[model samples]
Target: MNQESRRALIRKLVASRGECSVEQLAVELGVSGMTVRRDLQALCEDGRLIRTHGGATLGERATFEFAFLDRVNKNQEAKTAIARAAVRLASDARSVMLDGSTTTLAVARQLRGRSGLTVITTSLPAAAQLQHEPGIDVLLPGGYIRSASPDLTGSLAETNLELLRAEIAFLGADAVDDRGNVFTNPPDNSAVLLKMAASAQRVYVVADHTKLGKPALRRFGQLTQWAGLITDEACDPDFVDQLQQLGIGVIVAPFE
Candidate 1:
C-alpha cells in the first residue's frame, strides 16, 4: 500500500481497538515495524492519535469499548509483571477469585499447576486455562456470557459468588482515579467485580500504570476496599504513596 493508504489503515485500526501496537500493526499490514512506526508518527503529527510506548492509541477524546484481545496486546510487559507479583500474594491462599479482565487473565495463566488450590472465577478464559491442572480445582459461576468479553455475568454469577468466600481475590479495572476509585465500562462488569471483592477475605487490584490516575465510566470500588495493589514500575511514585497512606500494600513489579 502507499503511504496515505498505510497511514489511513493505521488510524482505522487504532480507532477501532482504542490502541494498536507497532508490532500488531506491522503484522496486520504485512509491513516492517519501522513502516508502522512511521505511519504512527504521521498520525500523531496530524493530532489523530497519541503515540504510546511501542504503540499508538486514539487521543483522550476517543472512547470505545475495550475488546479483550486489544487489551491482551497492549502493555503486555507491564501486565506480565503485575501478574507475577499477584501470583506471589496468592501462594498461600487455598481459595482464590479471579475476574475477567485481561490483566487478571495473566494472573490465572501463572496459577496453572498450583496444587490443592480452588479457583472460583467468572472468567471463561481463566477457567479454561486452570481446568486441566492436576492439583487445581476450577469452578465457574454459570451465567450469561458477555459476547464481547466472554465473562460470565448477571444474577446467576452473583448468586454463585454469594454462596462462597475466597481467601483472596485478584481483580482488574479499566481505570483508577486519584481517590482510588476503580472504574470499568458497562455497569454489569463493575457489578461482577464488586461481588468478587465482597466474597473475598482480601482483595488486590492488578492493573498497569497506564490505568492509574484515570477513571472510566463507573466506579465499582474504592481503593480502601482492596488490601493491596500490584502494578508495574511505570506507576507514579506519588500515587504509590497515596495508596500506601490508605494502608494498601503497594507492590511494584519490574517490567524487565
Candidate 2:
C-alpha cells in the first residue's frame, strides 16, 4: 500500500484499539518494519498519534476507552485466574488499593464477603461491587472520572491516595518486562498507578500472561517496586525467572 493508505490504516487501528505495535501493524499489512516505521513517523509528525519506543498509540485528544466492557471478552479465563492468584498475595488486608483493570475488578468481587477490610479502588465497577459488602468499607477516591474506564485520577485523587498508607496495593498493568519495567498505555494513567503503589507497604501486581511480553507506551514502575506478581501459566518462563532472580515472587494460578 502507499503511504497515505498505510498511515490511515494505522490511525484507524490506534483510534479503535487505544494502542498498537509496529510489529502488529507490519504483520497485518504484510510490509517491512521500516515501511511501518516510516508510516508511523509521518503520523507521529502530524501529531495524530504519539510514538513510543517500539509502537505508537492514541494521543491525548483521542477518544480512547479503557473500559472493562470493551476488554471483558478478550481473556476471561486468564483474568479470573490472575485475580484468584492475586488475592492469595494479601495475607492481612486492613486497607487495600485495587488499581484499575478488569482483573482487579474480579479480585474486588471476591473480597465482597471478607470482613474488616477497607477497600480502595479507582475502578468504578470495583467500587460498585464492594459497596454492599457488609463487612467491607469501600472508598472511591473521587476525582475526574475518565469514562473510557470510569477511573478517578488527576491531582485531587492522587492527593487522596497519597494520604492513606495501606497494607497492600494490588496493581495491574498494560505490560511487564523481564527487566522489571511495568508499562502503561498512557502516561497520566501510569502516574496514578505509581502513586497508589507508593501509598502501600507491599506492592503486588496482578497481570494475565498475555501482558508479559508486550511493551506499552508509558511505564509505571520497575519490577523492584513490586514484591510479587500473580499470573497464570501463559507468562513467559524467561520473564518469570528474571523476576525470581530479582527477589520478586511469581505465583501462578492452579490450572483448572
Candidate 3:
C-alpha cells in the first residue's frame, strides 16, 4: 500500500478501536514498526490522533477506554515499579481494597502469602491472583461485569462496598490533569471507584507517569481524595512539587 493509503488505514483503525499500538498496526498493515510509528507521528502532528507512550488514540477519545491488554503492555517497567511501591502500603493494613485497573493488578500479584490480610476487590484478575494464597483471604463483590474489563460495577458493587471497609484502597485513573484532577471513562467505573474510596480509611491512586497531565472524559475525583499518589520516577519534579503543595503525598517508585 502507498503511504497515503497506509496513513488513511491507520486513521480508520484508531477511529474504530479508539486506540491502536504502533506494533499492532504494523502487524495488521504488513508494515514495519518504524513505518507505522512514522505514520502515527504524522497523524498526531496533524491533530488526527493523540500519541500515547506506545500507541495512538482517536484525537478526542478521552471518553473511550483502551483495551485491558493494551494497557497492561504499555509502560510495563514503570507500572511494575509503581506496583512494587504501592504494595508496601499494605504491609501494616489488616484489609485492602484494590480496583480493577491494570496498575492495581500488578500490586495484587505481589500481595501473595501475606498473613492476616483481607483482600477486597472488584477486579476478577486481581482476585484470581490472590484467592488461592494460603495467608490471604480474597473477597469478590457481586455486581454486573463489564465486558471490556474484568471489573464488576453498578449498584450491586456499590452496595456491596458500603457493607465493607478497608484500611487502604489502591485505585487507578485514566488521566490526572496538572491541577490534580483525576479522570476516568464511563460513569459506571467512576461510580465504583467513588464507593471504594468511601469504604476505605485511606486511598492511593496508582498510575504511571504517562497518565499525568492528561484530561479524560469524566472527572471522577480529585487528588485530595487519596492519601497519596504512587508513580514512577519518570514523573516531573515540578509536578511532584505541585502535588505536595496540595498536601497530597507523592511516592516515586524507584526503577533502574
Candidate 4:
C-alpha cells in the first residue's frame, strides 16, 4: 500500500488496539520493522500517538482527531461522488486551492495522480494526502493550528492565502440554504474562506445532500459568488430548483 493508506491503517490499528508494538505493525502491514518505526514516529509528531519503549498508544489528541476521522467517513458514498464531480471541474487548473473540510480532503485524494499541479491548502490532512505526490507541489499557509480540526486559521493564514493565487478553489460548507448562502460551523473560518475564494479565479462549493437547505452558525458567502455548487444525486430536486431559480449554477454528481 502507499504511505498515505498505510499510515491511515496504522492510525486505525493503534486507535482500535490502544497500542501496538513496532514488530506487530510490521507484521500486520507486511512491511519492514524500519518502515513501521518510521510510520510510528511520524504519527507521534502529528500528535496522534504516544510512543512507548517498543510500541505506541493513542495520544491525548487522538480522541478529537479520531472523531474528525469518523466525520469524514459519515457520508462516504455522497462525498466520494461529490469529489469525483469536483475533480472534473478542476481538470484544467494547474493551481488549485482547497479548504479544510473533509469533503475537500476527498478532492485531494482524487487529485493525487495529476502532474505539474500546485495545491494550496490549510488542511493538514489534505497536505499529508498529497505530500508524497511527486507531481503535485503542496503548500500550507502558516497560521494557528485549530484544535477542533487539523487546519490552519487566524490572520496569518489569511494573509498568506491573500498573497497566493490559484486557478480554481474547492471549498466545503457546513450548510447551504435555499437562498444559496453558504455557512461554516465556526465563525472564524468564514474570514479564511473568504480569502481563499478571493485568491482563486473560480471557486466551487462541494457539499453532500445532507448539507442542503440548512444554515450553520456563520454565513460565509452566497453561492452566486462562487463558480458553482457541486452536490450528490441524493440532493433534493426542489432545493436544486430553488437555487437554480436564484441563478446559481448547481452540478449534481451521479453515483457510479
Off by more than 4 A, model 4: 1-59
Clashing pairs in 2: 180-223
Q: Per-residue alpha-carbon lDDT of model 1 for 45-164, expressed as tens digits?
A: 877789999999887433323344577879999998998888888999999999988898899998986898999999888898898999999989778988667689998888888888
CA lDDT of each prediction against the hidden true structure: 0.85, 0.80, 0.86, 0.93
- Clashing pairs for model 4 are none
Give the Å error, residue 76, model 1: 1.0
Instruction: Score candidate 4 by lDDT.
Output: 0.93
Ten residues in sequence with the least summed lDDT for candidate 3 = 60-69
- TM-scores of the models, in the given order? 0.73, 0.71, 0.73, 0.80
Q: Which TM-score value belongs to model 1?
A: 0.73
**Pairs of residues at least 3 apart in sequence or in different chains that clash in candidate 1:** none
lDDT of each residue in 109-219, candidate 2, tens digit only: 767678898988898889989888888998877788874666788888888888877898888878888877888786348777878889998888888898996788887
Clashes of each: 0, 1, 0, 0
What tens-digit string does per-residue lDDT give for candidate 4 at 1-256?
9999999999899898898999999999999999998998998998889999898999879878788889899899899999999989889889999999999999999998999999999999999999999999999988999988999999999999999999999999999999999998874488899999999999999999999998999998999978989999999999999999989999999997
lDDT of candidate 3 over 136-240, digit per residue (tens): 999987899886777899899999999999999999888888778888876438888999999999999998999998898999888876788899999988988
